[model samples]
Target: MKKARILMVVLFLLGICALLKCTTNTQPPAADGDEKTSRERGEFPDFGAMIPVAQFLKQYPGHKIFKLSQDYPKQLPGEDKIPAFFKMPFDDKSKWMDWLLAARDYCFEGMIDADFVAQDNKKRDWYHMPWLHYGPLASEGFSGLAKEAPISPYQLAPEQKHPGQVYALGFYNDFAGHTLYKMWNTSTDPDPFVTQGPKGGFPEGTVIFKFLYTELDSLDVPYLKNPYTRLAYITPTFKDSTNRIIKTMNLIQMDIMVKDKRADKYGTGWIFGNFCYNGNLNKGKTMKDRVANLVPVGIQFGNDPGYKTNWINPYPVVKTMINDTLKETFINASADLPPQHLGWGGRLDGPVDLNTASCMSCHATGEFPQIAALVPAQAFIGDTLANGSMKYLTQTDAPAWKKYYYNFKCGTAYDPKKATSTDFSLQVSLALEYYWQWKNTLMGGYYSHQYAGIQHMAIRGGIPFKQVKMIKKRGKKQKVDSLTQTQDGF
Candidate 1:
């Protein structure tokens, strides 16, 4: 009897170990230099069933060709190209603009050495984050344009803002790319925090640039004329159809975000910089002219801790409006940049972004199993006031309203009970969301997605989502919504 008890105890421990391994995480056996070596050796694990995207390049050969750079680097840039601006102190307000400009140029040089027009620069390498090519705004074409945010006709500089949508392509540098490879280099685990634990997040020196192009032209927004253009296959709209179409859109904004430890001293450990395209300033047809038209909109290092004012620069801005009170945000007063429609209380926001939320605030909610919505529920649906501004449905003094303004540390969970933070990278959070959506579709789920509350977060940032239909064992057909199941008030 004693011998039998001992054997049973050993078997019980083994079962627990195996169960923990399967439930807690999925580990990939990759070591030093493995990211590059494995790809070169073509030793890739199947990423499961591949979803198809439109192939307009084969149909129309006249447009400017685009190539999706996928060679993410495990190594960081050397001394010649290091981000020197980070070494400079942030207190020097005189040189803040210069530091931001250097950072912007660093991103541009990192992508294309021959300037914006160079598509074949061998030395310069940039990559697109994988797993974004799924669902409604699925990335299509070499440019990988994903249908993004919807712009209100009331939000523009020249008072000619038109209701239209923008498509964006996000490019990651070597350092940022490595984080992606580490997070998604395997099919066994796609969660950002799975391979790299919840504490592990994007390392310093990571930089990501998003190129935003809009369908609106000079007539719709008067400031947009002779804009830099690209032809990509994209699904026109979710409201209309998911069918792909070949279309030309003009560059309207360039948003750059960099990971730096120094920023942790004041706010989040990242700095966001925005640039707007003014075709009037850059009219030459060449790529150089189009790129030169991009003017610095601003740079943000913090969310101005303990500051929450119900102030906003009304849309249809006829002249520049810079709030003198914001200490963490710096907007260029250059006459060249068209009158800015800055975000909540004049914080950093891009042309394609909504005027209601700052760049940092919207991104603060990025976490796995995204329990928190990007904006407060009040900001989602509101009334259009007389000033062409959207009035918050709820009072700005609500507790949730001030939550986004708090200084959040890197890789720290926004809601500690439900999810792990993505180190303020909404792209990473969205990527994981899409991957789960695809996985759930392949092998059904036990939840009702049609009633899911995650729709609010999935609507604008990601590709369009459609209901998934499946037949159960009892022959009962149930329609489930995409994105996520009801996760609120849990």
Candidate 2:
């Protein structure tokens, strides 16, 4: 009888654990070091994670889940900053390659220094932006990558047949973490620094790097093979997919951006650059050597507002078109760099990015509430004829389309009335979108529900038929429709 009682208790406990994700989470999130008193004083409410991990674990027990790196440094301790490797302007012949190489090395070295489990350790300390694991469009599975864009059948190469999804994951250095800690210090509540805070935005030398992986393999792109691959347990394309599966994704692009205004005479104030993994350079004997195979795509600091080409390079790019006249863009034509369908007449975009948008063109619109669509309406809005010669955006010179190409200074919100600017951090804007949506789901709030982008979340691919008014500086107005999810990482 006693044995039966013991067995029943053991079975009940097992059932409870089996029904949920077994975790050592405690209330109020920050589980150590006088955090309760700090919370009482409104210091750091480290509200751990919002994914409702238990439910996700129950749903997808066989797959892996991400750990929230929310043990954010509440107080930035030192005055040291990442040294400016560029030293001179990015265009200076002496330091140009150094600038691009530094960005590449920064990304690669950081990835190397990260603990094997990624940002899950505080001692080895690289961090992920919290609250990105929310809706169907939020973040998917073990990779914790969000769907950024779709690749058409022949987008990357001629042999390509299957349409695929682009999944991206970005990491912030400790300096950027300082800014994140400040903005989320209030924990469950919106910090004043979020959209309109005096101390909002990253400090001068924050370096963020992202790795973009594609569901397409060597068969699709030909250049992707061997070590440049990853297995993603994500819910494929549109989150509307019922079952999630392990997709073999390949490393296609790595984007690195820095917050510095020194060389940005155009005043947009961020240095953006990316590299394309050239698998043809597969000469290494080890994994690191094979994976280090990258070709510098380009560096972009500002939108050449003066130069308007109104040109879009269609895919299956055979020859690289390097625009020699743009004042703010630079493309390396080395034999090492593969043929790229550059952004908006060769302004600095990577593989997996919409060929119609530049690095800055897509990132400059990072703000809450997403008053402006991430990309111009012409990129997808009105259909184009299949004649192969017509301009996709025939009205590319219109004020609305031109707005995306204009240089907006750092931290200037795209729409001041509805949201605050993240300078050029698209990850922050996307995180806010996911955070608010999850917040509203937990318990709806007046501000959370209204600003959670309820209408924009309903949108999936490109712009919908309906229109929303995009208000610009000088009270200018233009019709805007979201490309997808209110905002997404570029």
| TM-score of each predicted structure versus truth | 0.78, 0.78
Candidate 1 lDDT by residue in tens digits, 25-93? 675555655544335544332121112424434555564444445555555566455467778655355
Candidate 2 achieves a global lDDT of 0.65
In model 1, where is the ten-residue run with the lowest total lDDT?
463-472
Clash count list over all predictions: 4, 0
Clashing pairs in 1: 136-464, 137-463, 137-464, 450-481
Where is model 1 more than 4 Å wrong at Cα?
A: 1-59, 62-67, 75-81, 110-119, 158-161, 194-198, 283-285, 380-383, 386-388, 391-394, 446-490
Which regions in candidate 2 have their CA more than 4 angstroms from the true location? 1-65, 84-88, 113-117, 120-124, 192-199, 381-391, 445-461, 464-490
lDDT against the true structure, per candidate, is: 0.65, 0.65
